[model samples]
Target: MDTASRTAIVTGGSRGIGRAVAVRLAAAGQDVAVVYSSNAKEADAAVGEIEAAGARGIALQADVADEDTIAGAFDTVEQRLGPIDVVVNAAGIMALQPIRELDLAQLDRQLRTNVRGTFVTAKEAARRIRPGGAFVAFSTSVTRLHLPAYGAYAATKGAVEALIPILAKEMGDRDVTVNAVAPGPTATELFFEGKSQQVIDRIAGLSPMNRLGTPEDVAELVAFLAGPGRWINGQIVFANGGAA
Candidate 1:
């Protein structure tokens, strides 16, 4: 992939899959800018790990749901890291409950962070990312599986998948690829919250592989799309360990 000197920005890089991707991209030889909405400590830690991976890295703060903030983040990355060749939008929130018991407030929050946040960042990437660049949006395999309580969250991701192809087309022979990664039952803190061991085991068993996925597992896919998987564009690659 020859990503040496290429640059990337990974939102939500403070923790979870985003953290893994930031470090992995650095390992692949791309300068990295780690973006966090808050949590300066974790953000710094992620950047530290990136530097440990032998790439120059910096940490920036931006609310992914805010257009101005996210745009400012892009500008900062460009000014500091060089022109961005890859953008991974991994900042998101998830709260599960049956549709009948859904919390309207949570739904609003999810839509803001998951859907609108992705849109704001993606809009910037579409305009700014260099030709032959890649934009990776995080979705959920639950959207296709249609799990019981994921209605609102799934709807927001469905919107993400819907927008990807259009954005890829908009790039229009520019050699940039816009796509989404739909992960199922990853072992991140966010995914583990509020779930009992019994429930977790059942979900893990749903995968033909008989276990949950790791953040690094998903990051490998993101790194490929970011660097080597240029022809695999305008699609969602599900990294669920054969689950769902």
Candidate 2:
């Protein structure tokens, strides 16, 4: 892939880190395709942001968990934007629950979206992304924090993190770097949902910075991995503010 005309596909680009990544990549000179599952309004707005950054942007709807739909979305993107150089699978869901009180249905949903969705997207990226491209998947810092009520969500992301190294090695011959970004508590709508201010403060205090991460914070790291951080592959990068 030529650096001058690289194109990127970002799943879950309707909001949060994924949206920030799409805008950032666009600002960095990549034509970006925002793959959204629902909410066409938000997806269209994201494309507006991308265009404002002076790059071509398109919105495509596809469930990341469905292989056929996602594969078609990939084909559409390449057909419209030329070959893809970056694939970011940031589409996911979270439902906090203790193991003893786990809801099987919720667990299944998370597994389908977080685990299977990533696999489907990664498979497409492996097949289509050009040489010197990148594939970034999302994990969570909760997998290491081992927090209560995050068992199911963390488990799904753990499975995602497990795919990074092996996939990177497999893509080595193609010169496509594969990695996962594990973000700490972030100040997105998703993170704030169902959480009280007091609880949010305590979680923020866990980081040395004493604040939750912004979508842009994680986006910056992802942009690096997708762009010039090619040497750093097959690893789970923790994008927390010294929250260990």
Candidate 3:
């Protein structure tokens, strides 16, 4: 799709990679709706960045995991910015605990916000996005890395990856594309918090690039998928610096 013709809704766009993706889409001349569950200040800041890029920007708050909230959020976006030509499902949660110690509550939370959330968001996108639009879902390299305590989290992302192909086929008649981007260890606030310097260094060393991925790095890949990368559909593009 032409950048100028794009109108996108990015879930969890208030901060980190989601915010960066929103900014990048705006830079590419796509009007953006930045959706957030909370943190009005951050969402407003993201809107400012998008507007600075000379694209229409709006902030809408909703829980992507909730069907009603997701519907309401998309309605607001469509009302404010024309039909969405791009939908980026970047909203997710990560909680780590060994399988033996993993509680039902944590598992439910991850499934609701990660797997089910992606499903709800993409289902809505499938129904609402313009015929030639694109849908991008977020996955994680932890799935490939097979970390000890990340089984549950990885399962959620794995489910997302599994759904992309089916979604692509379902949306094929409309010429829409579906894909997922699996990022490695990114330097988002979520990754940095409670980590010691040594731990961070070790995590960085795990990647062949010898550094953690940045939000902008992933955003660049997302921009490609949203625009020129349309031909690449139903695939998991790992933006992990060759880690796993």
TM-scores for all candidates: the values are 0.98, 0.98, 0.97
lDDT of 2: 0.94
Residues 21-122, candidate 2, lDDT per residue (tens digit)? 999999889999999988999999999999999999999999999999999999999899999999999999999878999999999999999999999999
Q: By lDDT, is 1 or 2 better?
A: 2
Which regions in candidate 2 have their CA more than 4 angstroms from the true location? 1-3
lDDT of 1 by residue, 34-91 (tens): 9998899999999899999999999999999999988898998999889989999999
How many clashes does each candidate structure show, in the order listed? Answer: 0, 0, 0
**What lDDT is reached at residue 22 by model 1?**
97
Clashing pairs in 3: none
Worst 10 residues of 1 by lDDT: 165-174
So what's the TM-score on candidate 3? 0.97
Error of 1 at 176 (Å): 0.6
Output the TM-score of candidate 1: 0.98
The global Cα lDDT (0 to 1) of model 3 is: 0.92
Clash list (residue pairs), candidate 2: none
Residue runs of model 1 more than 4 Å from their true location after superposition:
none
Model 1 alpha-carbon miss at residue 28, Å: 0.1
TM-score comparison, 2 vs 3, better candidate: 2
